[model samples]
Target chain A: MRIFFYSVQSEWLKTKNSIASWLCLVGGFFIPLLYLIADIKNKTFINSAGTEIWQTHFTRLWMNMSGFLLPMGLILASSLITQVEFKNNSWKQVHVTPQKYSTIFFAKLAVLLGMTLKFFLFFNIGVIIAGTVPCLIFDHSFPKENIPWLYFIEKNARYFIACLPIIALQYLLSLQFKNFVIAVGVGLAGLIGTFIAFRWQYIYLSPFSYTNPFAERSGFSENILLYATIYFVVFTIISFYLYVNKKIKG
Target chain B: MEYCVQTTDLAYTFSNRQQVLDNVSIHVPEQCIYGFLGPNGAGKTTTLKLILGLLRNHQGTIKIFNKPIAGHRVEIMRSVGSLIESPSVYGHLSAKDNLRIFQKVYQCPQGRIDEVLSMTGLANTGTKKAAQFSLGMKQRLGIAIALLHHPALLILDEPTNGLDPNGMVEIREFLKLLNREHGTTILISSHLLTEIDRLATHIGLINKGRILFEGTAEQLKKEKNRETYILYKTSDNQAAAALFARQNIKPALLPDTIKIAATSKENVAGLNRLLVHNGLDVYEITTEKNDLETIFMNLITD
Candidate 1:
């Protein structure tokens, strides 16, 4: 367990100047900054009731996030994190370390998961900033409705759960193939396939469809989060198997 | 003798069914520089990879420090450090940062990083990202990383592959000093025999996936010396050849000298005595031994 911790720490150092780190910070604030601009320009919050204002704000935020940004962000983030080793031509170096293949695999996966968590943290903070800036600039009274902190937490947690399978699968692709284009290309194709099949009765069977349906509450079953968890586990297990059993890692 | 690394009948086939190694066995003794000499594509890197456990599902066993590498790979690897092919480094990070990552993995003290940096002559390269490093600098950083944990054995594949003469000399000196001072057993591979010929105490020559020669450097020399020829200049070269012919010993007669196949020093002495007894003054009897390159070429080519 201590060795695994060390592996995770080492893996995190590899991302110091990498694109994945930039993706996390920039991706978090990208949408909220645009929304902030639009709200301030239009005075959208000057006369709204507190509850109505809060509801509208969350709906707009979650709509973009769960529908497009989160999935695509995950696809890019996972690939970027895994490709750091390949880009540096250091896979053989990592493999020759005293750590086991399991340690290296899980440590990298943990860092990817942590990057997603960071993105969400920054996004939530950005959401709050976006909501308050317009009210302050327009000299409007602050919303009287209590911040629905529990609701925000639950929704973010659920969406994060829904995106796990995508993260695992993309990580698998990135680790298995050294080419950056192939991993991201396959991920983009999967996202497009989900949109084309969005209306199908069994579209929920695809892990890519997990985020949009869970957020909109339109097509997927109430057990969609559980299904996402299952897919994540299955993909993770398969990734570990392929990684450990790989004949020529270097 | 106790061995630092030993492999027996190890074989590997690629996914395309190409046999890269066939019944290749190597033994590296403790605290000695075992030079793995081979031409390119002779399975040197593949063999090293299998021994390092980077390649899996091989045909035979690898025992390092007398423990099988199969079940005890991680445990065994704790005492083994390797730099295979190119240096493994993150170009965006400085040499210090690159070593820090491995230090954390190896769980060594922070001070060891500085030790290896200076050991590899990289202590002055502060804040310079590895990408900006020269090939020799990158190679040195790789060696520093390998030595960070103070492993008992270091496996380096062509550590001097793309270096200038000075760079190669520096690496060679560093390795010799490491072996002498720290008792670190080194298994260095190179395609150029001359590169390791002066550095290696023992040698294992590989070609076409088979080990053509495995023994001490002195023994390799002796193998070449077995075909020595004696060229002697006498007062009468013609009579000198005729004197050996009477004893059923054929000598090649030249205008100035007689050349005879040398079986031993005793035989050479007897031939010289025969010349002098035949009223021919034996002036020079020089034994010509084949050079190492010739012997290496002859062994591998055949």
Candidate 2:
């Protein structure tokens, strides 16, 4: 257990030192800043818009930001965590340790998951800032009907839960490829490919398309939750199996 | 006494279908600096990997500390430290931070980080990242990491590959200190004959994935008897050989001189007296001992 914590701490330290983390922070703030300016201008154009307009704008901004940013954040985190070992050819160093493989594997997984949570935290703050601007600039009263704080919590929880599989898949992909570019490229290509496949409506069976669970008002369907749970469990098992069996050569 | 590492009929083939290691067996005695001497592509690194369990698909048995490497791998590996090929370090982390990270892996006390730092002479470069370190410093850091856990066995492959002469001497002295003080069983592989000759007590000379010879340096040196040669500028060469033959001594004939294998300095003087008595003038006499390079060359060439 101590080994696990130490590995996790090391992974977290690397994430903190990464250039990708700075880019995520800058990009996170920029996205919400742009949306807030656009929403303020949109409110000024309307003659009689109420709190409902502001609430809808807030939900849309949060959803859109998370839809794009969270996956990218996961990709960055996964790539960063795996790239450190790959770049320095330190896999042999880690493997020769007395720590169990599961402990090391989960430590990296935890860091990737934690970074994704951090993105959500920053994005939430951005959402609040974006929501506040329209009310201050246009003297618009916030819509109480769309401000379902409990629903917002439940929906974000489902969204975060849905992202677990992508985190696992990204970790696996990054581990499979020593090059960060290949990992990130494959992740982006996967995201785009899944989005395109979802549009065609032919491969609804694909799990990547279901990465975003709270996009609509489905209110966390039992079916989607079940599928996501199975997907998460299956991919987690497969990724760890491959990692444990992978040959460590310097 | 039990061996620190023992292998039986080990073989490994890479993905390119090239046999890197054939059926080779090696025995490393406990607390001895076993020099794994071989040329490039002689399967030294591959053998180390097999012993460390870093590479699988090997058809053989490997036992370290009397434990089967495959069954009790973690338990056995915990007591072993290795620096294979190059130093494995996080280039972005400071020297201190790198030690701290490995300390966690070894589950050692925090003080060990400082201990290894001082031991490897990296104590003064606390804040310097590994990328900024010189090759010798990095090699020291690598040794520091290998020693961090207080491992009983250290397996280093070409530890002095890229270091300068001073660095090599420093490492050699340090390794000697480690062995003398801590009794750490070191198995170091290198092609540098002089370094191994100076350091290793027992050497396993390998060639083409096979053990050519295994013995102490003295034993190898003793394998060939020291032959003495006499450079006699004699008046008649054939008469000199005829005289030695009549005296029951076989003198080897060279282009310019006749050589005789004298047993000792006294024997050389005795032979000179006999040659002078027989009317042969001896101008110069030379003798050479079998050094490691000559012995190694003889072993490989033969």
Candidate 3:
């Protein structure tokens, strides 16, 4: 366990100087900033009374990402994580270490899962700043009373946790294949597939549809979250098993 | 013999049904330079990877430091440093960062990073990422990473593949120094026998996925030197050749000397006595040593 955390810290360092990582960070700030600028410019946002504006904008924010961008974004971020090792030929470097493959595997998976949650936190902060611009600029008051901190955390954290299976799937793809386009291409195809299966009663059966439950409604769906959690557990097990047992070919 | 690494009846087939390694058994003794000499696709790197636990599906046993590699991999690998095939590094990272990655993994002291950087002669490469590094620099960085933890054993596959002659010589000298000063057991592999010929105390030759030979370099030289040839220079080269032909042994007469094929030093001495008794002056009888390249070529062909 000590080695596990240390490996996790080392895994995080891979992204320190990466431009792709910086781009992903900028995305967290950019998405909400774009949405807020558009929302604040609209007359309907100005005419709306009280928490309705926050609710509508927040719903739109999660929906836009949860529908396509967040799923694809999670795919991109996960691919980037494995990309560093794959493109750099660092797999052999890591494997020759005293640390077990299981430790290294979990450390990377945890970091990607952590990044998924991080974007959520930053996205919410972005939303908060941009969402409240009108309240402060036009209404001469902060939207503190209007912003649901608990609700924001609850929803963002829920959606983030719900996206685990996707992250795991991406990690598996990236591990299995060397090229980033194939992983991201498969993910984009899955994102498009989610649109077709999203309204189905059993949407959570698909890993990509986990975010839909959070985005389509105000609260979490017990059945879909339950299903996503089960998938997360299964994906984690299967991916780790394959990673440990599979031969690393040069 | 106390062996640092031993593989018994190991064989492997790829997913595409290409069998890369076939019943290969190689033993590397402790505290010596073991050369894994093989042609391309001769399973040298595959064998190294098996010892490192990078490839798990194989048919036999790999014992490293007296422990079965499958069972005590992490513990066994803790004392091993390896550079398999090409240098494994994050090209996006600076040289220091690459060393730092392994240093953190091995949990070595923080200051050891600088020691390795200076040792590999990359201490002055500030903020220069590995991607921008020259091939030789990357190779040195790989060695630095392998040397970071100060492992008792170092397994390097084709360590001098991309190096210039001077770079190769420097690395050879550096490895010799490491082995001499620190008593580090080095297992290095290469397709070129000359590369290993200069450094290897012990050698294992592989071809077509099987180890053709494994022994000390001197042992190989002794086996290679089995056939003795003496170049006999004489006052009368033709007279010496005719004298040897009288005994039904043909001697190829050159301009100033006659080449005689004899089994042993005693045979050459007897021939010298016989030629001198036949009114011929034996100026010099130089014994020919079979070069390693010839022996290596013969082994591969056989």
lDDT of 2 by residue, B1-302 (tens): 68999999998888788888888899999999999998888889889988988898888899999888887887887899999888888888887888777786777899988888888778999677788888888888888989999999999999997789988998999999999999999999999999999999999998888888887878877766553344555777788778777878888887777877656677667767877887777776666446788677766766
- Predicted candidate 3 versus true structure: per-residue lDDT over B9-112, tens digit per residue: 99988788899899999899888999999889889888888878887678988899989987798898789999988798787789888877777788899899
Query: What docking tier does model 1 reach?
Result: medium
Off by over 4 Å in 3: A39-49, A132-140, A144-146, A213-222, B228-289
Pairs clashing in candidate 3? none
Name the fnat for model 2: 0.52
Sort by lDDT, best first: what order?
1, 3, 2
Output the number of the DockQ-best candidate. Answer: 1
* Candidate 2, pairs of clashing residues: A51-A142, A51-A143
Please write out the lDDT profile of model 1 over residues A51-135, one tens digit for every residue. 5666568767878877878899999999998788888888888988888889999999999999999999998888888888888
Weakest 10 consecutive residues of candidate 2 chain B by summed lDDT: B224-233
Instruction: Give per-residue CA lDDT, model 2, range A75-160, as digits (tens).
Output: 77778778888877788877777767788889888877777777766766776777666777777665445555675567567777
Winner by TM-score: 1
Task: List lDDT for all candidates, in order.
Answer: 0.88, 0.77, 0.82
Error of 2 at B219 (Å): 1.9
Instruction: List residue ranges in candidate 1 displaced over 4 A.
Output: A46-52, A138-146, A213-215, B229-289
Better of 1 and 2 by DockQ: 1
